[model samples]
Target: MKDLEGKTVFITGGGGGIGGGIAQAFAERGTRIVLADIDQGFAQEEASRLPRSVEVMTLPLDVRSPESWKAARVEAEARFGAVDVLCNNAGISTGFRPLFDIPPEEFERVMAINVTGVYNGIQTFGPLMAARREGHIVNTSSMNGLTPFASFAAYSASKFAVLALSDALRDELAPQGVGVSTLFPGLTRSRMSQADLGKISAGDPARRAVIEANMMEPVWLGRAVVRAVEHDEPYIITHPDYREGLRARHERILAAFGDPAQPDYHTGMTATR
Candidate 1:
């Protein structure tokens, strides 16, 4: 995992935004890339723009579709000897709305892409990494996963699911020597904001303001992911400014519960039971 040079990275959402930035970062470092996106033309276009010497392949992928993931994996393995890394980065927002106000179909759609899509990526490629005993999986959660927002209930829920899944997978995959990294990114300049927010009703000014305030350049977040992979870091947080807020939230939770038992001090104890 430390050595990215010549490693093959299979990336979802590779057509544009954060995914494209990540692909370019790796490609610049001489890593081979397999670009998978919902839009086949965009995927191929991105692949075509990669450095001439870098090995690049493109696949039309609907992250929500298990069959698409299966085909993509098969093609990726066939094109490259084995995928050294898998980036589960494709996701969508449920247009800014309160939990009850959001349509059920919108919630379902967001969950399908944001949460279930990540699960599919892991289920499909996790075994291959386990067999090789040398691979990395990066699942992109969000800052909203760490801190709840009033307007983004569905998106927040899906991201929280991703965060929990990444934590569990890291421990599960440790014995197999495959690295699992979870990313909690603050707002990034991406299609999610443009497409999802643009679709929102014009009356929702508060939600629009919130989205605008959180925005950061996608390339910056992409570079952070590259560093996370290189360092084998378990959790990657893109925005440093959010640390104080996160700490305050943790403190509030601890105050309400009178301090949870420490794992190190409590031996042979299960939190679930």
Candidate 2:
């Protein structure tokens, strides 16, 4: 992973703010890039920003579809050989609406694109990397995944699934020589984040400005991702300010571990049926 030069990196949602930042970070390391997105235009736009010397390709990829992933892999490998790194970063949010206010379809849509999309990517490319025994995977989770909040239930649930998927995949793939890392990003300037501005600021101009000012740059997260891949780190946390909140939540959960709620139950008992 330290030797990234000449490596081929494939990124889903390569058109978005964070994905573009990731592409840029890898491109800086002389890694060839495949910027795949459902909106091919956005992928191309990001590719155009890279230096001409960098080998970058843009493709239309709907991460929710396994067929789309297969086609993308075929085309990408045809152009630049097998992917050395895979960044499953494509996702959608359910906005900041309350859980009850959100429609069933909206919740399903978020889970489909945010959670299933990552799974599809993993299924498509993970085996190949495992066979090669030399590759890394970076799955984009969210700060909300670590610390959930009201009005963001569906989105938080989807991101939380990403963390679970990444963690399990890491354990399953590490022994096979493939590294997996989960990125828990906080508010970074993106189309999705901008769209939530009103709700986040509660229509207050000063609050809106302050929130905007505090938004992290997408490239910084990308840089952190790059470091994670290089070091084979399991978790990439870009926003440390939320650490206390996450710690508190964990402590609360841990405190609930009392007796198994049954007078005769023992901790080491194994199920026989």
Candidate 3:
């Protein structure tokens, strides 16, 4: 995990914005790249752009499908020894809509790709990494995963699930020497937002405004991910502004607890006074 040179990275959504950036970064480091995406053409195009010296393969993949994962794993291992890293970077957003107003299918699709898709990646690639006793897994959660966002209930819920999943997996994999890291990227300039949400008309102007405001360059996120892997960081957060929000949320949780040593809150307060 420390030295990426000549290692192989199996990346989901490699044709997409953040995924492409991640692939490019690793490829630049002389890492072998296995790029998977739902769009075959796009994946192939990205793979072709990588340096000739780097071993590259592109496969059309649907993260929602377990069969797709199995096939890709087989092909990757055959092409490059064992995968050194698995980047679960593929995701989609349901755009800005009140929970009640959102279609049921929209919620299901988002959960399938954003939440279950990540679970599939971990489940599929985890065993391979375990066998090697040396590997890294990076799951992409969003800034919304750390804090609730208005009109993005489904997307937020899925990301929150990813955050919890990554944490649990990290604990489970630690003893095995496999590294698990979760990425919380802020608004990045990616096709994920535009492609996923562009179809739905935003009923509220304020909601649309908030979405537009959070967009950042995907390359910034890519660089952060590379650094995280180098440092063996468990949690990679892209937005600095969200730190205050995370702190506030933590404070709220701490506030909810009473002194466990005290049988009665009134008595405890009276003694302190």
Candidate 4:
């Protein structure tokens, strides 16, 4: 996993901000890349930005469909052999609306792409990587996944599921030499972020400007992702500013673990007369 030169990576959402950035970082490392997106044009456009010397492919992938996943695998493998890395970065947002106001179908759509899409990618590529005994899977979560607020509940839930899935999958894949990494990014420059900013700061131009200025360039996040895969790191936290709040949240959860519910029911003592 350390040396990524010549390795092949398949990235979902390759046409968009973070995915494009990740493709760029890996391309710079001389790794062959497959930019898979629902929008073929976006994937191709991202592929176009890479250095001419890098070997790359662009394919349309609807992460939600098993058929699409299989097709992508077939096409990418045909072009580059087995994929060495899978980036489950394709996702959608639930907007800045309250959970109650979100439509059921819209919420389902978000989960299908944001959560189940990752599941599909792993199912499609995890076995191949495991059998090969060398590969890395990077699943994109978010800072919201760590600290969910009222308005962002649905998106946060989907991302939280990503974290949970990656954690368990890491253990399951470790013996097979496959690595799983969870990427928790904060506010970054992307189509989703821009739309979120608009919803979050409707009339407040000053607030919108401040948030826009703080947005991290997607390439830097991509670079971090590349490093994480190389080192087989489990968790990649791109924004350190959220650490304090996360720590506090963890501390609160810890405070609730005092004792078992039934005081007289001690499992250590065998039930006998």
Candidate 5:
């Protein structure tokens, strides 16, 4: 995994801010890239930003569809052989709406893209990586996944699922010589984040400017992802500002653990129950 030069990397959502950043970072390492996005134009835009010497391609990919994944994989492998790194980074958000206020369809859409999309990518490409016994996977979650926030319940739930998926996949792939890493990003400047800000601020210039000022550059997050892949790290946390909040949440959960509902319930005695 440490060796990336000449390696082929396939990224979902490659047209978005974070995905584009990740592509640029991989380009810096001499890694060939396949930029797949639902919007082919965006993918091409990001691909254009990479140096001419870097081999990069853009393809329209609907992460929600297995057939799309199959086609993308076929094209990517046909162009550059087996993907050395698979990034399940395509996702959508609920725009900071309250849990109850979100429509059922919107909630479903978030889960479809944020959670199922990652699953589809893994199902499509993971087996190939296993057969090769040499590859890495990076799944993008969010800080909200670690510490759920109000007004972003559905988004948080999807991200939490990503974290769980990445952790389980990491363990499952370890024996097969494939690695998995979960990226928990915080307020990175992206079209999605910008749109969210516009919604909340009602396009208020001052508010939008303040939010923009605090946003992290996507390239920094991209570099972190590269490092994680190189070291086979399990978690790539690009933002530590939420550490205390996460610690408090975990401490509260630990405090909640207590006696079982039935005092006489023993570890092995409940098997038949």
Candidate 6:
């Protein structure tokens, strides 16, 4: 953890903005990077953007397929040794649509990439790291995961699942000397976000302008991820503007916690029964 130099990092969605940003950050720390994405061309593009001195491998990875994961891992291990850090960053958004309005197939695709993809990455790489008794995993969630909103129900649900998975994985890996961190990025500049904007706010130049203005540079978030990895931090909140909303959500959940509605409900000391 202290010295990232010479470590190997396998990152899903490495072709995208956030993944590229993460690759750059880790490269700066002298870590070898494997950029895995469904689009090999985009992965190559991101790889080309990295420092020439950094060791980088680009591979096509369909995170939804275990076969793809297996092939990627084979290539990665053939190039570099065992992966020291796994970044489950590949994901897709379903645009801003109400829950009932979203197509079931589209909703399923969102879950496949955003939620199940992370799970696949964990299942594929977790044991290797655990056996070694050292490694780290970074799963990218969104600010929406912490504070859900109306139109983004499906995306938010997938992100929420990522957060839960990361938390549980962290607990499970703690004893094995592995670390897990969940990244909550807010309005970062990425292809997926830009496309979502087109879908949800297509002709509204003004709305797009404001959102663009607020979009954080991907590298900045990447730097935060690197710091989190270095410190083995559990949660990485790059944008603090969402804290107030998160606070309100937490408050509501806390308010709902009350004594059991049964007179003879004596469950446990920890439970309020």
Highest TM-score model number: 6
Per-prediction TM-score: 0.88, 0.95, 0.87, 0.95, 0.96, 0.97
Per-residue lDDT of candidate 6, residues 1-273 (tens digit): 468999999999999889999999999999999999999999999999999999998999999999999999999999998999999999998788799999889999999999999999999999999999999999999999999899999999999999989998899999999999999999899999889877766889999898888889999999999999999999999999899999998999999978889977876667320
Q: What is the per-residue lDDT of model 5 for residues 6-68, given as tens digits with 9 covering 90 to 100?
A: 999999999979999999999999999999999999999998889999999999999999999
Query: Once model 5 is optimally superposed onto the true structure by TM-score, how far is the C-alpha of residue 99 displaced, in angstroms?
Result: 1.5
**lDDT by candidate, in order shown:** 0.86, 0.92, 0.85, 0.93, 0.92, 0.93
Clashing pairs in 6: none
* Displacement of the residue 25 alpha carbon in candidate 2, Å: 0.8
Question: Between prediction 1 and prediction 2, which has the larger lDDT?
Answer: 2
Off by over 4 Å in 3: 196-214, 259-273
Instruction: Score candidate 4 by lDDT.
Output: 0.93
- Clash count, predicted structure 2: 0
Give Cα distance to truth, residue 273, candidate 2, Å. Answer: 26
Per-residue error for 165 in candidate 1, Å, reads 0.4
Clash counts for all predictions: 0, 0, 0, 0, 0, 0
**Candidate 4, which segments miss by more than 4 Å at Cα?**
264-273
Error of 6 at 114 (Å): 1.2
Residue 171 miss distance in model 3 (angstroms)? 0.8
